[model samples]
Target: MSSTRTGLLLVCLAGVLWGTGGLALEILRDHSPLSVLMVSAYRMLVAALALLVASVVLRRGPRLLALVRAYPGRSVAVGLGTAAYQALYFGSVTTAGVTVATVVSLGLAPVLLAVVDLVRARHRTVTRGTLRLALVLGAALSGLVLVSAASGSGAAVGTRPVVGLLLAVACGCVYAATTALGSTVLTSADADPLALTTVATTAGAVGLVPVALVGGGPFVTSDPVALGTLGYLGLFTMALAYGLFYTGLRTTRSGAAVVATLLEPVTAAVAAAVVLGERLGLAGVIGSVLILTAVAGLDEPGA
Candidate 1:
């Protein structure tokens, strides 16, 4: 298979892994004492620790350090932004229903990236294809809104719609910026994706120290199920998924990779239906289809 295809597959797999994270969070809510902020911190801490151990075992410590030293500001910015977005996303989930939070936050990322593309292309002649791509973005966002609406009807848990929307928007912006910054790391000479991911997680963990501590309490939990779930989140969702995502960036366009992650919400919806017995009504089905189509469309040669 082509490298591009491999990259897209890796990214799509990352998205699928990400979809399961919500379920893990739910488990934590039921069994763990960690607050949302603390959960984010622990995610970073565990992922960083896992990566560190792997680096030592694989004899890549020197290379990881080199990657960090080469792009200190960029690495820190990406990691810090990543942690900030996670905190904001969980905050939004509290204020906005999960559907609204996930859809809006993830939906806005591609739109923002497309806007950046348009700005960069302002000097060039506009083509019909570019216009079509813009329309695709609009459709994808529309699908997200539909999904959010369906979610409200089916299982609305949010109490503050306005606040949640704002937070979700903020999360999207941060997510977009962080993703863009992370792509830069791949462009650097002798870039190592594994090293970059290790550095990113480490930096994110350190960056969240103050905020996690401020949230306080609920930091320690003795429940084995909760502990195992937490480990799954860090190891699979953050570490493995992010590792694949960065590796994919080596071959995939950043914008396309972002769009490919639409699979995340779709995967989440399906998983909820199966695992949580959440019913995805007709509207949800339609929305998921639209999103899937949009995701596939973004992979067209020029797109």
Candidate 2:
């Protein structure tokens, strides 16, 4: 396969892995949502450690260290955004139902990001293709609304009502900004890929430590299944997924990259139906198709 095709494959794989988080967490529903948060924290921690070990084993420690030193500030900023996004996302899932929270959070992120991109494009005129992509995004969000209506379940996930929604929106915003910032940092630093992953993951883990502390220790399950799931999250979803996403972004346009990442929700919906045996009503199914179509439209050349 050509390089672009290979990058696209990696990007889609990353989206699929990310989408699996909800289903994986569902398997551990008996645990506290805080436990989910702790698991996420630990995922980063483990991912960072694993990458560090791999770097050493591969005799790339010097290159990794050089990159870390060169881009310390950017790494810290990206880490902070990543940490906040994860915490708020887990918190949102706790406050809102998984499907509701995931839809709202992920759906709104690109909208906010598009607005930001438009503002940034003020100096440079917006292209017709961008406008078309925006329309498709709007259609996708409309589909989310329809899907949400079809579900008909209304139990709040968190203690704070409005605050939870606000936090979830904030999480979306942070994620959008982080994607933009991370791409810039990675390109400018000319860093060792493994080292950057390790630094960002470690930084995110460190940020989550206080939340883990406040929530109390022995944060997650000792059970083999739960531990195994968390391990997959760390090794594949958090580490490998993000690494592939960044690599893909290096070869793809930002707009196309965001649209491609929408595959996460499509994968999540399918997983929910197949693994969790959750039925999407007719409206939900229609909405899913519309959303997928819109996203595919956005991925068209020049869109």
Best-fitting candidate, measured by TM-score?
A: 1
> Could you tell me the TM-score of candidate 1?
0.93
**lDDT per residue as tens, model 2, 202-294:** 888888867777877566566777777777878988889888887776665454556567777667667877876777678778877877787
Overall local distance difference test of candidate 1: 0.83
* Candidate 1 lDDT, 39-131, residue by residue in tens: 878888999999989888989988888877888889888888988999889889889878778788988899888877667667376687687
Q: What are the clash counts of all predictions, listed in order?
A: 0, 3
Clashes of 1: 0
TM per candidate comes to 0.93, 0.86
Highest lDDT: give the candidate number.
1
Candidate 2 residue 77 C-alpha distance from true site, Å:
1.6
Q: How accurate is candidate 2 locally (lDDT)?
A: 0.72
- Candidates' C-alpha lDDT: 0.83, 0.72
Off by over 4 Å in 2: 1-8, 30-34, 119-126, 146-159, 217-220
What local lDDT score does residue 140 receive in model 2, on the 0 to 100 scale?
77
